[model samples]
Target: MSDAWSHDEVIYPELGRILSESQGERNEEIAYALAICAGYAYAEVKGGADKVTLRKRLARVGLQDNTCKPIELSVDAMFIDSTAFVVRACEGKVAILCYRGTEIADLTDWLTDIDTEPETYSFPQAPDRRNWRVHSGFYRSTRATWDDVMAELASAGPEALYITGHSLGGAMAAMAGVMLRKDQDPRHRQVRDALKAVYTYGQPMIGNVEFARECQADPFLRDNVIRHVHRNDIVPHLPPVATGPFAHFGTEFRYLNDPPGLESPSGYWRRNASARQAGMIDFALTPWEFVARRIPMAGSLVARWRPIGAKIEAVADRVEKAADTLHVPFGRPPSFVCYSIEDHAPHHYIAKLATPGVLSEFERERTSVS
Candidate 1:
């Protein structure tokens, strides 16, 4: 088992079927494809893959030449880098924007993730933008590449646009959706009119209650934004609403549970409580684990020392087992067990989306609603 951060290959095994069925609409199959695109965006950003390499990778997954293009954008502040891929599918009528999540080694990304202070949303086209407050870090990240993303969308000229991303990228995607929908600029009207849906995985809350209310008030956003929270992913519960004005708006789909399906706010809260507990435990052990892994024989000495040594050894054993379960740190993986840090990994999302009957069930529900 290798670290997901180092895994660069992006292959959608069901791409051909997904592309054939989705046509030009939003569906589970399309969502799955976009998730793959999101993962590929990470590869593009981290590996610094060239256009030829990106095209070749997309071609391997059945995308035709010129159907998809990678866009890399960065800001001077904290050297914040943002990467997305624009895919013109369904004979160029449907466009998908896929944003890359945070890289593990990037200090700037972690800083962006932790900067939860709310700031007034600044968008000239939005009439009530002054009243809207959003996560400062995410807002800066989205604004950094806003011009370039809009330029790509304008150039694509698609009839419908779908947005998707994982983790921090998901935050950016949500912000982009709001900004694009609010933009009344005539030059961007085509792109704005084309905005259809945003699908995010393991995304954290992006705004205040007022901001959420605005998103809910807009029929387009209310009907189109879909959030996917896979099991015990810890990201979605971030920037704690209890402590701040942070909030989320969108239809939430909870995956990888028994009778996997959607979850209401109350149900989500119940699950969140459990995840919070696990997160606390993980947090407490993080420093010790870090020291143990670095210093020579530290783990063994800690386990064999004194009266409390037995308890420490037992806890260490559990951590080892959890790490083995996902070949990563227990604090990280998205899991059905406890809240895991690794659960936020894109590979977990990719695997769950590729699971049999998951997308089919989601597609059935979507079609019935339509």
Candidate 2:
């Protein structure tokens, strides 16, 4: 009923107990438990609820107010240490779940190969193009990555699967959710088919028109994929021009003013806010800047390593231009847009370019840059 509900108030202890028992394994319980906790934490920050209020609510669900603590959070991962219990739901049955954070030897396989051969790729160079096909290549690559990840999960035949990630990880999770919904692999199809949901926090836009349509049309993807974004976190504002499924993804933009300080309760909240804002900004500008400048040797390698005459440079130009054009229609610019005393000027970095009158120039820049 309110903007957001506290985890303790919202999560049922009896349900948690039942889920844990049914899951039958500590690792599975840990995974589902943390996801549920993460979802609650997201709600608290987004809603701007007081810490005391959230803590009191968590107590209702059998967790102590002091149990939750912030831990290391990485690009594609997060680690939270909390004493709170978790429940697992699988194949229409609740149990204590079993899970492993990762068993794959090279989890980095999904990422763009920028490390080993840094100078191979420059950003895609192209003309000013807003067509659907222009964006499909990036979408397809990410989609395929998730498909592969889900296929591996399907092999294990788990009860119910919950996927989550922050920022790029979130983007990856959304793609995984889409593929898991329609996965036909009969081996672990039961668990794949029983996917509980996906929760992506501060996830960027990952795909284009048809890709969005495919995600929205699938029953599992439509209801289970929950994406949360902080109001001024610009990374989520990427791959512009939504098809169908992504139309509403950016609408529920989460707003937080500052990082929670570690010294006090309020400080803790502010530190989280600050960290999220910083992380989002970094996610958007860092890699592209590196790629755009042709700095990473591996990147240049990937660019040149492409199929004969790959239009990598040309495509990158259009992506930059398109990002400039697609302004989110959220109700208002975030308070931090004006208040934050940051050296990097996010508000006006591409300001004039976003104006209707400047389209030709943005296009011109797109063409000549490549």
Candidate 3:
């Protein structure tokens, strides 16, 4: 088993399917369907994956993958697509549910609203953070697809559940982790009740301070939620900690080097090594630098509109400081700074988790529990 197995494979093999690239045809009936697995799946969705192909790749993993066919979640809501699959590997029955991330191509065409509007969400069953508010856009997108995924999982029999996603999809995966923990769906309450763990990559802050503390204290989340942030990728700091009160939720795993087993096939170690030798530009950027880089990414698409209090000056300081605080505690100095967008790519995560330092953290926890 190579180091790229980010999660403790003994406990979360299904998730391994999400991180590995497939190496063959979906119908090959032999080994991996492609060189890259879900990484290739990510490319299929600049619209969405061809259902036939996705199902085939999933089948190769010894599981059945199903979707809410017309999850047709309002395009207005970002929940572009959803899939539910059941793994009957040696680990017994484990179901995995995932959300497709923001279609960058989708966002490229539309203007984005960055305003922060704190709003309460109503759920029939009270969750740990009912007062919980979320990124309005993300929350809207989750509305339908969550129901669809939950409904499917509901019908699927009791099993340990593993929830995950990357990027915007990562944020939604976090929320589904929370929602599933609640008795929201009586039908699959057993499965939800058994949510084993939540693994999200490049996720953004989903709610305000109240929701953040709520999740921090929530028993289910305290032990299970793991957010992986690569050196300085920009999305994680978003919903701007300075703007209002939106805060990130979960325990963060930050890695400076690649995880032991999973080395980048292209030998990214050399690239990162070369970048670091030039003064290790991997550290966090200063307020001005952070904003300078961030602003350009938003480009002309993001409205300069701030909801009343989103003063550019005030928020800048808070976001910068918050980045330092959240990123500093877990790793050493070089791991702190984030220099490029490449840091946000799953390829990097796939590489980092393959290393022992970060990957071992997960292995240790699973070992302790088992």
- Per-residue error for 169 in candidate 2, Å, reads 1.1
Query: What lDDT score belongs to each candidate, Candidate 1 first?
Result: 0.65, 0.35, 0.48
**Using Cα atoms with residue i matched to residue i, what is each candidate's TM-score against the true structure?**
0.67, 0.38, 0.59
Tens digit per residue, CA lDDT, model 3, 171-281: 767877777665454576687665766767677777776677677777667656766666556667665434465776666655443335644322222211101110223
lDDT of 3 at 289: 41
Better candidate number, 1 or 3, judged by lDDT:
1
Off by over 4 Å in 1: 1-26, 45-57, 60-62, 122-130, 241-243, 258-338, 355-370
Please name the candidate that would achieve the greatest lDDT relative to the true structure: 1
Candidate 2, residue 168: how far the Cα is off, in Å? 1.4
User: Which wins on lDDT, candidate 1 or candidate 2?
Assistant: 1
Summing lDDT over every window of 10 consecutive residues in candidate 3, give the lowest-scoring window.
270-279
Give one digit per residue, the lDDT tens place, for model 1 in 124-188.
64576466788888888888778888898898897777888999999989889988988878999
